[model samples]
Target: MVFPERFSNLPEYAFPRLRKLLDVHQAGGDPINMSIGEPRHPFPEFIGRAISEALEGFGRYPPNEGGEDLRAAIVAWIARRYGVHLNADQHILALNGTREGLFNAALALGVEEKARQKPAVLMPNPFYQVYAVASLAINAEPIYVPATAETGDLPDYVALPAALLDRVTIAYLCSPANPQGAVATEAYWRDLIALAERHDFRIFADECYSEIYRNTPPVGALQVAHDMGADPDRVVVFHSLSKRSNLPGLRSGFAASGSGNIAAMKQLKNYTGAPLPLPLQAAAALAWRDEAHVEENRAIYRRKYQMADEIFGNVAGYQPLEAGFFLWLPVENDEAAALKLWREAGVRCLPGSYLSRAVAGQAIGQDRLRVALVAEEQELQRGLLRLHGCLYQ
Candidate 1:
């Protein structure tokens, strides 16, 4: 049996490739992982209690669309955070995680063809892996725009040729961009939204790391769209408990958009989506409603940001993160730097090329590496010290 050709060129996922590259050499000192973005902070105290109280719901099939309480909680959070009021039942669908929503939104929403040709899907050169696969799965051209230093780490669809923009049916973007930690400001969103309006494409805004930032909270795409009064169908905003609430295990998130888009997603989900279990959904609702836990979580990240600045302050080109936990540290050779860090410094970090695609024969992240600051204070500090001494000196 022959498989589809669309995924033939896809590379191995980041982590497995990293293990192959580093497992041969023994770590030079005590092992510390600054690779994955998993949060090491103490998860909210109430997550456990909430799960225990809702255990009985597991005996029944979970709601495909979120239950009233869970949806209401999510809607309330949006209002409190973005000032956009939405009808909970009509405009939202709870997701197992935003990854599922991000990928499936492409399936449910992207057109197979536009202007009588295979449509295009736009994404940052180095982005969440799902975006590329989502575009390919739908048989669309995956346009990898440069979100590099020159572009301020956000893809500029506004600069794309009008002919190409007209073929775009979907564009995926991440704010507080992973690894880079760059955020799309309100003005940036307005320009992007205006571009979408002109070209008639949809923007899938991945705002998973919106809560953890240094100064101002990153603006939400949905908020900007609401303010501009863009067509309701233009933006599908996805958010998650994984980063915001430090609850990746909860597998809980939601997508909000026009009721029409929600209905299409729900229709697709009804047949194919794996509904988040009822008990976890109940617990997640509590997480969304409570801002105290989120505030504490953000405070922890802020402290880490200060710690990073103190450590890397003297290192030229070390960008103070605007938001999110990862540091897109510059290195002469990312793979070589990663190997040296593992062999000499006992620190494991991801090579930048693993996270990005090549454009015009030049890989976007070949000269950099990603260092996650998700570990506890002392451990993360030690790891950062090792990284700097091994590579920067």
Candidate 2:
């Protein structure tokens, strides 16, 4: 039997690779997991009641597109958060999670043959693994751009060669970026939107971490696009309840794009997607409608950030995060640093290289480790202190 060549060169998923690297060693102290970005915050208390009330509907099939009420709730949230009003019927589609929507959108909209050559999908080096998988699934070439400190930790697609840009079909961007915690500026968004328009590619803005910021709320891709009067179809932003409402288990998220893109995605979903179950949809609606819990969750993250700052502040080469929940600390080598931390400190973290690939004559994430600040306050503090002592001290 022949295996697909598309996955032949693909690296093992992060967690499995991590286990292989550290499973042989015994932790030196009590374990403190600061590795995965799974939120440890409390979800809404009302989710159970909402689910119980709507449980009967589960016997029936869920709508391929989201239920009207759920869609409206998402619309309202978008309006409140981004000031971009979306038509629930035309511009919103609830997802199992943003990952599903993000991956499926590529299949729905990414056209490899339409480009002057084999289409290229642009993504940050240390990107969400789904972006590369989706690009490969569609037979498009995935171009990994370095999102290192030299580039402000955001991929500069505008800097790509015109020949490559002309062949580009989609660009995946993450604001309050994963593992690195870097947020793109409004000016950055404007430049990117202009590039997309000039090159005729769509921007898949993955803003799942939009709600988990420190200072002011991060500027959104849709908001910037709308302000510039850019073509709505040029940018499609994906948001989720996972980080925002501390509801990762709910698998609730939505995509907001131009009517045409949304329509195309809806049609594709009708054939291959399963929308949120009714009870889950109801729970998500309530979650979206409430901001109090989100604020509370933000407070928790803020506290953890301060704890990380206090613990790692004196350590040389520690780059305190500006947004998102991860600390991207410079080290001699990510894999070795991660192993040492796990073995000596019992603190687990991801090697930065696992999140990125070498591109344009540089191994973009070769000298850093990504420490997720998703544990509880006390645990997070202890983990940061251990990381500081193990890696920096």
Candidate 3:
């Protein structure tokens, strides 16, 4: 049996490789899992009631794009939050999760045969694995742009050569970026939007982590695109209830883009996408409409961030995160640091290199490790202390 060679060269998903590295070690103390990004906050109290009330709808297959009420709620939320107006019917599509939308958007919008060259999908070096897979799945060349300290932890797509930009079909950007916790500034978004407009490629903004931040909310890609008067189709934003409402189990999110792109995505989804369960959709509608629970969730993450600062602020090579829950700490070697933390401190983390690819003579993430701050206050404090003691002391 022959298999596609494209997938054959892909590295093992980060978690399994982490398991192989630390599973053999005897933990030194009570285990504190700082590896995965699953939130430990309480979801809204009404979610259970909402799900119970909508349970009957589960018997019916959900609409592929999303129900009217759910889509409208998402639209209203976007308008209120990002100041970007979207027509629910024309520009919004509900997703099982942002991952689904992020991956499928590549298939739905990625144009491989435009003039001659194989289309390129540009992504940050240490990026969400889905972006690379999506690009490869569409038979496009995946370009890993470095988003390390040298680049302010955001990929500099604007700086790429004009020739490469011309062949670019889509650029995947994560603000409050995964692992690094770097939020893109308004100026960053403006430059990127202009570049996308000039090059005629779509910007896939993975804003799933937008809600969990410190100080001001991070500027959104769609909002910047609108402000710049770029073609509406040039930017697509994916958001989720996973981080905002602390409802990862709900598997609820939405994609907002130009009418044409949303229509194309909806068409593809009709044949291949799995809609959020009807009951979950009903719960998600309420989740999107309510911001009180979201505020509380953000407050918890803010407190955790403070705790991290208290613990690691003075440590050498520690860069405090501006937003998001992960800490990208510079270490001698990511894998070595991770193994030491697991065995000596009983705290598990992901090695940064696992999340990035080598590019242009540099492994951008080679000397860092990503620590998730998704545990409850007490556990997170203990984990942070353990990490500091293990690594710094």
Candidate 1 — which residues are off by over 4 angstroms? Answer: none
**Residue 315 lDDT (model 2):** 72
Which window of 10 residues has the lowest lDDT sum in candidate 2? 357-366
The candidate that achieves the highest lDDT relative to the unseen native structure:
1
Candidate 1 C-alpha lDDT tens digits along 219-319? 99999999999999899999999988899988999999999999999999999999988789888999999999889999988998998898888888889
Q: Candidate 3 on 82-148: residue-level lDDT in tens? A: 8989899999999999999999999999986655999999999999999999999999999999998
Q: Could you tell me how far off, in angstroms, the CA of residue 209 lies in candidate 2 after the best superposition?
A: 0.4
TM-score of each: 0.99, 0.98, 0.98
Candidates sorted by TM-score, descending order?
A: 1, 3, 2
RMSD in order of candidates: 0.8, 1.1, 0.9
- Runs in model 2 deviating more than 4 A are none
2 or 3, greater by TM-score? 3
TM-score of model 3 vs. true structure: 0.98
